[model samples]
Target: MFTRHHALRAVIVTGLATGAGLLLAPTASSVPVPDRSAEHALAALVSGPPAAADLALPRDFGRRFGYRPTLTQGLLGDPSGSCSSPVPLPAEFTAACRQHDLGYDLLRYAGRSGRALPPDARRSVDTQLGAAFEDACSSREEPLSLASCLAWADIAEGFVRVNSARQDHAVPESETVRSIAPGVGLGLAAAGGVVLAVPALRRRVGGVR
Candidate 1:
């Protein structure tokens, strides 16, 4: 009777060990992962020197709004469009911009430090804004007006740190990953979870490891 019980217990232990071991192992069956990086880009319609040039002015104006239009708009609502346009910044975006100023978003080179970024944070800012504008205009032939251009530029630039949530539906990675590390970490974490869940059963073949 005791022998019979030990055999049953061993069989159960083997099954469980095999299952958990599989969890730690790599699986041959894998899901194709989606790529999501926000390398600070925009619509391909807004590309080239001319589009870049046209987009330049509005972006400059956006930065002038204290290099914080995006941050401000993200946190507090700017109904007056005081920063870049008369068109109010969206309520949610205003809060985000505000959060950015509150040290929610850390700028690497824009300021002396992440918390105490300089007010005249222009050159680096302009470059970031410019790159965003250039991306938005890459594919389209239309030229965004100064206000519209600034609006888009603010959204794109601040997005680098403001972090947008990812959805199952695919959109421009440029827009989504503007928040930097969050997106990268989010992607990697998700991939890790899936990768570690099921390992390749045929790693050694013919038997479970």
Candidate 2:
């Protein structure tokens, strides 16, 4: 009986060892990974000029606003199309200008931080601007004037979004890595759980003495 029990134990141990060897074996995907540093360096070298231009927000700000008439309307001139005179702007138009400036400043800060607006924050800003635009455009006082102001704000916000870190071509590697690590970690954890369960199989066999 003792010899039989010993033989059974040896078979079980050998099976478990084989199973572990298979589990730990290097699959096709486990082959040596290629060095991406060279590729990344080459890409950065090629993209240097364009990346610099995109980051130069303040320098391009004037030209961009100048080309967009709606953006300059309330900013450079009053409701009566007077640019030189210092007259008080209509309330809605003033608010529009404020919002546009706010958005522009916020975008500059984000650019400096090397980050993009989160979805919730972006959606909130869009919704708020949309609501304000509708209110101002429908107002009885200087409706056309206020409409121009809201249009300016919308254009500024659009520019910010386009130049932001959300652009696929310019997105940081850190962001992509952050998005993928969690799923990979979960897969590894599941595999580890299976490996851990293997040790418990010996307790279930009725032949062990």
Candidate 3:
């Protein structure tokens, strides 16, 4: 029977689900687009060698994004991000990770400035990251060390590629969640409806008998 208990339960479940969905949904914010020249320069830096990247650091990039590029152990520094993997990678991979972080930052900078790069831009950056990882492994001369590095490189690249596929290209991380929130909300609502309907359907069948 659809007793008072069932009715109360349904109301509570529906309310919670709807409320959560609303809270999780993304909101839009507007910011003036920075000059295209700055974005172009950042893109070039991401693609170019680490030595050349330092040249752009002192220009409009530092003033606009508050990004002060530093040099660490001869590699470009990425204080804002790093190789955040569950398992430790070879130390040589540090340079590759720093470069990859720069590419992601470019995407974030473009997004916050109201000018988003195309999806292909992200793909291109990711591809380069994988290549960099491979190159790092290739540098190992010892047979065992070479094998181990190559194996880790495969694992790292696979993880990165999969994660990248899940993200919205050139969008800030928070905005990506917002973009997908409505679909998630609708799914939750649908699930709640099914739960409530099952009890009602059972009660109706009992009455007919």
Clashes per candidate (backbone, < 3 Å): 39, 0, 0
User: Which segments of candidate 3 are over 4 A away from where they belong?
Assistant: 1-35, 57-60, 63-66, 71-80, 172-209
Error in Å for residue 193 of model 1? 52
Instruction: Name the runs in model 1 displaced over 4 angstroms.
Output: 1-85, 88-104, 107-122, 142-209
TM-score of each model, in listed order: 0.19, 0.26, 0.58
Model 3 lDDT, full chain set: 0.63
- Ranking of all candidate structures by their lDDT, best first: 3, 2, 1
Q: Please list the residue runs of candidate 2 whose C-alpha ends up more than 4 Å from where it truly belongs after superposition.
A: 1-94, 141-209
Expressed as tens digits, the lDDT of each residue in 94-202 for candidate 3 is 8778777776677776766667677776777778778888787677665556655655665667666656677745453544566556545544454445444544444
**Per-residue lDDT of model 2, residues 33-150, tens digit only:** 3223322322222233323323333443434344221223222211222211022233554544444343333343344444433433334433444455455555644434443444
Which candidate wins on TM-score?
3
Worst 10 residues of 1 by lDDT: 36-45
Q: State the number of backbone clashes in model 3.
A: 0
Query: 2 or 3: which has the higher TM-score?
Result: 3
Better-scoring candidate (lDDT), 1 or 2: 2
